[model samples]
Target chain A: MTTPPLPQWTALARDAVFTDPTEMLLKADRFDQTIRRRNWREYAAGVSGVLLSIGMAAFFAWVGDYAIVGAVMVTGMGFLVVMHNLRRHASPVERLPEEPCIEHLRRQYRYQAEALHSVASWYIGPLVPGFLAMQAAIFWNAAQDRGWEEALTDKGWPFALIVAFLIGVIALNRWAARDLRRKLAALETLD
Target chain B: MTQAAEALYRQAGAQFAPALARLARSVERDPEKARDLEQEMHCALWISLARFDGRCALKTWVYRVAHNVAADHVSRAVRGPQRVALDVIETLPSAGNVEAETAEALVLAQVGELIRRLPPVDMQVIVLWLEGESAADIADITGLSAGAVATRVHRIKALIAGHFQSEPAYGVTA
Candidate 1:
């Protein structure tokens, strides 16, 4: 197979690099929106967890159930621990150093690897433990006064809804995992 | 953040955005995928911005982020069997002021097909070169030594030259 001429290659490169005006701006705006939305979701979830714990504790205290209050505290504390662990494990962003050109690219590849790994951890870390802890709490609370069937029936719908939500969350997590894995593999090919 | 830091990011974005986007297009071969890569790079850059201590040129930092983002994308594409094929070179539309749009399109199509056949690294080198990256800059972005960059460029040029020698009517001789 003969190689194409320089002019042809140059022309091809020009076409490849040239941006469509509408598409370029639209992409930038869309990217900005995605970043904003992702940040908002994370913030909202964090706030919601804290609020839910506080509300649960207060409601239990008002009803004079010290035991339930303690449980709520444990749950709240567990959530905080998970959050702290996540923060600790989060990758630190690299500072670019003044360097010769080749060094810069090498650093860039290293940074990319770090960032991809960080994202992968974020996707897979909490779901399993968090799901188990919540389920255990539900069962423990329900078991205090009645059999499993009785407890389930009394709050079956809500429990069922929670189960459904967990399933949905897991499914979404799997999809994300698959996506990240693909990206990581592609990076490996480059190196 | 210092004024200098913020200004650095803005400058980095302006300088690196097009080249990074072009790289994404070459690797991903789909506009939508290219857009996704761009956004991911933008987010990565924003996250990493705080660590910018004026140690390196902002352009290099941005390219590093862009390359990482693209690498991640390529990895993901590999694991997903449903990913579109990488034979995108055959589909690229030609540029330049040709009188007949069809001829332009055909030339572009052939060029794209040939490009896809090159090794991935060569593809990257050629694409970056076409984007006006100097050999030194290409070495930096690609993590290859300068000598290696020259060698790869020489090989790529020869390959393109040979490809056109056999198809003269295409007017693609190097």
Candidate 2:
């Protein structure tokens, strides 16, 4: 026997209520705009933080104040730690269907893991260097204000500390990105 | 976007809106939820319009976006307690126009319920098939190869046929 043609009339009856598409189209546009605005807001926040860091460095340098510079360094480090923790702890936004086929579910999870890894790398790769550069500029400027001998002797310990901190930050960022990627890859291979 | 892009959006909306609504209703199983999904899909499509590089037919792209939106909305609804209150419980006429329409609606509703029970990929294939999408179009929308779509279509049809045959009282009237 031949297979039946699809019940086109039945489908049409089901959709009888939604005859107008204009409203749907408009709502879609509005949602798109909202998402775009959200992304812009996140970008603005990041730019603002970077600007504040630069501003603090400049203000402290003009006043030859190591105390204020030290405070700013601590504040910047604290902000980075908070932002990193918040990002790391964020829940996955897209939830999978409850009873998806095993194969399909696996594929979906793999895709998500890959995406998360991409995002983590995208964030960490530039963040480490940018963070270190800002810290260096601030510390170096404050040290230079003193006479050459005094600056060299006084700044040696602080400069060494900053270098160590930079190395640690870069290593930590790279490790976090790589570890997340590896864990996600492992999830893809699980039963 | 240019005027041509804007016109395309308008034209695509006019041409595909009814069909998209039908597809959403079939999968969503609730009217209010269907409307919500439709709105979301429409919004996504418009936003994604700029990225449409003419690599695929406009209809195929619209269907893919609509299917994704409906799937996402339904998943959320199932997980949440906000049980979609049956939209106003539409009244059906008792005779002639209403009778035929009601019979048709009942059949479609049963079909929709059955389709919902299938695996997501299979359900998508069946819906696309019912929408008169070609194998090639289904492949494009699904990111599956043409051969894979054809195989899945055969398996899905047999599954639906078996389901209707086994559950005689489930609206399979002579």
Candidate 3:
């Protein structure tokens, strides 16, 4: 192997990269500040998500007939946001700088893959029970206006629309799961 | 633990600062970004030392961390543009007009640029070998088998030999 001597590259690096010793000494101090800032940003986004979910729940609850569906959605969105924020911002590896790079990469991939696959649990699953309650409530609330048979028959098309909507939500989650699975499979090759 | 980590940081940082700088410089073309990467490398070393169990040689550990950081920096930089394989690069021609006086510097810069474009595994081995690491050391740092490092080193040598114009006084030049 006739490898060219790389003195020029080394020289260029030495000239360009070497800094005052003080800079090296103070790196940890600066890193602390960066970490604090990042943490603040993460918490801020999470708080906003919680607040938005509350607002959504409140607005939908005010709609009377759609109150149950709205509450379920609020719960679902809140759970998803909280779990996602935790995974995205508060990764253990970010603080554990000593962890090998390959380990870090694998950790990140693992988190993302789990997050993607969990759309049903933290996201869609939370909505399922609440959604069923909401549908039952919709029929009951409609029944107060007329006879039970009248309410059921009259509300048929609207109930069909709501069922279609829920199916669509699950389908979208499945699509996301499939996409994440592909990414996870690709990432596994590196491990 | 803090004092031990700090002492180790200073010791390792002093020893490998030059190599880490070279790694960062190889990854980033912009001086400002390279400086930032260099600082990041230092910070990483300090944090990484807290967990340094000495399972591997200190030199191997440092490059593992340094190259990982540099590769991440390079990956971020390359995300905006399409990257080609090294084979594609091999088919391309080298610049022919660099004067002997400036040929060395230009070649070094071009080599750094070429390195920045490579995939992470290839990039890591090539960077360590170019920086004068032995095959065993490269394997230690990269977690690749010794045979793998030898094969990669061979390929890198051939790649460089084919692409870079050589002079009799390569590293001896001013």
Candidate 4:
């Protein structure tokens, strides 16, 4: 059979009512409110983390565990650093929606890739000082109680596991960033 | 919203509202969900118009923002039906033929089915094409080169033709 004439696809919505400008603006305001609410939630979580870390550091210091206090203080600093990073990269500068789709998509991919690429510094590195201090405190305590040999024997596996987990996280982020960059490259060639 | 933005939105709503509704329907099958999607598109368009500097044609900007919102919606619906690439689209079964008095309605439904199965990029191209946009205009909206748009349009046409061929009794075309 010969191909029949195509229908006017726009006719499918011939009776579609144009939403009023006031209603549209209301919807836009609601959308903005939703985004603001989400941002507030993220801030709440980050603030809670910082406050908890600070409280922990203070308690540790009061108990005369200066080593743990140092570790806790470093961890508190880590929370602040992480919060800053999250806020910075939480969203890219809002671009005009009039921009071409490819450009918008590229921006999104680049934003993600950049965030993942710096995961080691902002995400992983911040915790390293605190992690090491805590480990050192444990090692010193065990060594004083028993001996360095027993401390190494007893704590070796746990230390190795922590190191392995951190490395794994960094490696995974690197792989994801690479993948996003590859997608970015592909999208670049699309237009 | 500023008066200027509201004025622009009114213009866009007056001009592209039907097309936008059809676009939402193309992406979302359920009527309730489609209406929600349409409202979302309207909301996005209204906000996006705040930055409208007349750098591009209003039609182009409206379509770009609406399609982007639809793409985001699809991305978030990870558990929804999976879309396919253009090359492999023909392998998928066509929509079951629905009996309607007018061949146009049937063809519209069939085309809608085809659109919903396509990846976002291809879906944008075909939707623009079916809405009577020129290849250059589609290129402007999608940021695809003119040649890329042409190539995709040709492939999409072939796929649509092939899809309809499988159901000869429909006496329909897209």
List model 4 lDDT by residue over A1-191, tens digit each.
Answer: 12213546756677776678867657767878999998899889988988898888889888888888888788778777877877887765475556787777777778888888888998888788888888998888899899999999999899999999989998999899998798788777777
lDDT of 3 by residue, B1-174 (tens): 387877776677667787787777666767788878888877767667778988777877778878777756664563533454454566222434534356566666566667766666667777888777777777667666777667766765665555445644453321
Best by lDDT: 4
- Residue-wise C-alpha lDDT for candidate 2, range B86-117, written one tens digit per residue: 12212211222223234345445555655555
Per-model interface RMSD values are 7.8, 7.8, 5.1, 5.1
Which stretches of candidate 4 lie above 4 Å from their native place?
A1-8, B2-4, B28-34, B80-84, B92-117, B169-174
CAPRI class assigned to model 4: acceptable
What does candidate 1 score on TM?
Answer: 0.49
TM-score of each: 0.49, 0.50, 0.69, 0.85
Better of 2 and 3 by lDDT: 3
* Residue pair clashes in candidate 2: A28-B43
Scoring each candidate complex against the real one, what DockQ results? 0.18, 0.08, 0.28, 0.48
Docking class of 1: incorrect
The lDDT of model 2 is 0.57
Clashing pairs for model 3 are none
